[model samples]
Target: MSAGMAGREAPLSRWTLLAFAFPAAPISAMGLPLVVHLPPFYAGSLGLGLTVVGAIFMLARFWDVITDPVLGVVSDRFETRWGRRRHWIVLSVPIMMLSVYMIFMPQGPVTAGYLVFWLFVLYVGWTLLTISHISWGAELTPDYHDRSRVQGARELLLIIGMVCVLALPAVIELANPENLAAARVASMGWFVLILLPISVAVAVWKVPERKAPRPEHVPFGQAVKVLIENRPLRFVLLADLISGVSGGIVASLFLFLAEDVLRLGKFSSALLLCYFISGVMFIPLVLWISRRFGKHRTAAGSALFNAITVPLILLIPAGHPELALGAFLLFGVNMAAGPFLFRSIMADVADHDSVQTKQTRTGLFFAMLTSTNKVGAAVAIGLSYMMLDVVGFVPGGENSAAALDGLRAVYVWPATIISAAVALILWRFPLDEAQQKANREILDRRMLDAAAAAVETRTLHPGDAQSSGAPAD
Candidate 1:
């Protein structure tokens, strides 16, 4: 019934989707491996205590929770020639590169003071870039399936990035121990130098920007009130947080299991590379299933699959490297499905919010999502560290039986948390196929009404109008 819905065309090309998706690959690839591997690296290599390492990780993530929302609000309010979201993407790439370089290649001694400061800066910069990039993707299309396609492309690219990061560290060490450290530095630098420019170019050249409507003099307090009052948004945020924490717990502990339990040694990097590559391999399969079954059902099935598969990872006894590799491969398959569906659901939630409020608040929606993910990351990293401390995890040492037992506990207990999260997702995620269709229709109507209003305003104020102008004006 709505004007915007009367006739809407699908996206013209895959390039349009790639424009939004490609940039995310480098960012996700960089962030996921760093979060998974860096804590252990700092604890063992830098000789920081578990609690101290945990504290630093948690502090930086908590800082992201606060700043993410601000960034989202700022992006939503932003109006620019390069376009609202693209400009942020351009600005964030170099900063992200510099921050990552700093974190991995610390200049001074590995003192607590130095570690904390660099970690804080790196985490904040990464969060800013990610929040902006994600928001930009959400705003690219209002169509449901198109949004999924966009996300799938982005996620696929992200997996490629992860594989690169995950594999390179070990490859460097194995090939030449004499220059292992130099190789590590060069690998990161090369990816940053090469991928950063490519990502920005794709985003600028390929993705079309939407002209977001300016808010009609609404107060900041009112915007907050609307965000808080929206039940669907609230549910989506809570579920994402719960799921994020569960995933984060697994990620934070994965390296420890490979190194300490499986005794994989330098091969740990290869195993991780395989895990990421396996996830990437499953993207097409997940996307296919999602198309057939719908996003929520597909996600629920993946969560259930993960609930069963991830716990089996605990069954791999010490001295069985092949079994561990098999487990990671299986885990990666299930993990791949969840993200594809999860990101699709997130875009749907964004559409629902736009319909309800008559505003394109992609940045705010993604900001909230990112904030919860940070909270989840905080809980996972903080608690894993605390648990390590409790279980007598000794960094950079031959594992005593007690330390090994602690490592096993970290591996096993998080299963319970993950199981509960899957349950919440199955029961509480209220946005289903029919609901999404209805919401899309509503959004189409709103966009039509807004467009009509602009036309009427142009007619009334003819002197101020230009026949062909950019969307932002």
Candidate 2:
């Protein structure tokens, strides 16, 4: 055990957790803008070719996926006085800020090359900040319920950020759908710029990093072997992909669903706001449910709940705002559960791995999951759009009735099946509250043993006793 884990307690305070999670606000604010707002803004507003812009975004995502693991490996191995995770967070700030600025505030004529270069740079920065931030949070506590509390607060702040960005564009566009072209996207950019630094500053200044002993550097081949044997991680990553793809399908089809199926095209913003608000309001309830049922079981239960409710949108009669609103409200019940639970569960998985292998590879585990999540998102968006295009469903529903049905089919069925699979796949997930506690005990024992060995070694050779703290692996 490294000196950092000697006499360490695994519980955290509310203030500490809050400070630890605050950066998620700005980071979450960047998500909707990058995925939803930026593409249309560039193609439609700036007159860039739609095909070219789409290709550039795809290329950027590919680049982002590749970098996630590399950054994770780097964060886990790099040690410094400042900390492992926070230094990456600090380094990522300027790169992200510049990327955000370039994407949202383009000056001269934009080309495919320009979009490709800057978008790739931006996602690399996003991956670095996000993977490190999440890996840091996972290391903060070993208590099963404390993990939920920390992540629940992050989800809350994330919702606040999402609503802020989503509402601004909708509010501005609602008043006059044609007005404030750049300002809509620009507002989110400015929000990220202003919020990113302040949140990072607070998190760094207030939250203390837990410097666990670094594991002996494993070669890449050995790292792969270790990962292949991490059963809990594999199970959770499977759940993550299934649930993430389902949600992504919904997001990809949301605007089309509201416009053509529900006839709420004019009030899409209001509909989105209703969904987010409902999800945010219900998080406390989910937290309580998690405490009672435990993380994996609760996650599976929520997936089942979503499976039951999400597809009901297909049955609602067209041109009925009341029915659509009611369905969205119901669907919102499980919206926050997927993200909140997956994060908490992954933490447990990391703990399990550390206990079994004597290595804390939180960063690499998180990065691999992050990369797979992007794959799910990409598949959902691409497949849904391709399916729509195949069925002759135009963007504005300016098409035949058959085309609308095609859009509706693509929207509902994939999500229904995927959510169902999430429940089935995760039903037997290995790590639970009791199992995690046992794992923590093993880790503590190993830590104490290592520390004793170090002390004995120093006593035997007094000249070798370096009055210094070492990281615990």
TM-scores vs. true structure, each candidate: 0.91, 0.92
Candidate 1 TM-score to native: 0.91
Candidate 2 — which pairs collide? 1-450, 212-472, 213-471, 213-472, 213-473
Scored by TM-score, the top model is: 2
Q: Give the per-residue lDDT of model 1 (tens digit) for 186-266.
A: 576467657876887877887667755665655768767877887767766776787777877878887788777778877
Candidate 1: where is the Cα deviation over 4 Å? 1-7, 179-186, 464-473
Q: What is the lDDT of residue 147 in candidate 2?
A: 84
* lDDT string, candidate 2, 1-473, tens digits: 44334334656887887888888989888987776667656756776744545556555666767898899889888878988899999999999999999888876788777887888888989999999999998878767888888888888888888888778876667567454769888878999999999999999999988758768555767767877988888888888876657776788567668876678866776777788888899999999998998888888999889878876877888888888888888887777887988898998888887866677789988998888777777666656666776888766537788998888888888888888898987888988888887787777777777767887777776655654443222
Give the top-scoring candidate (lDDT): 2
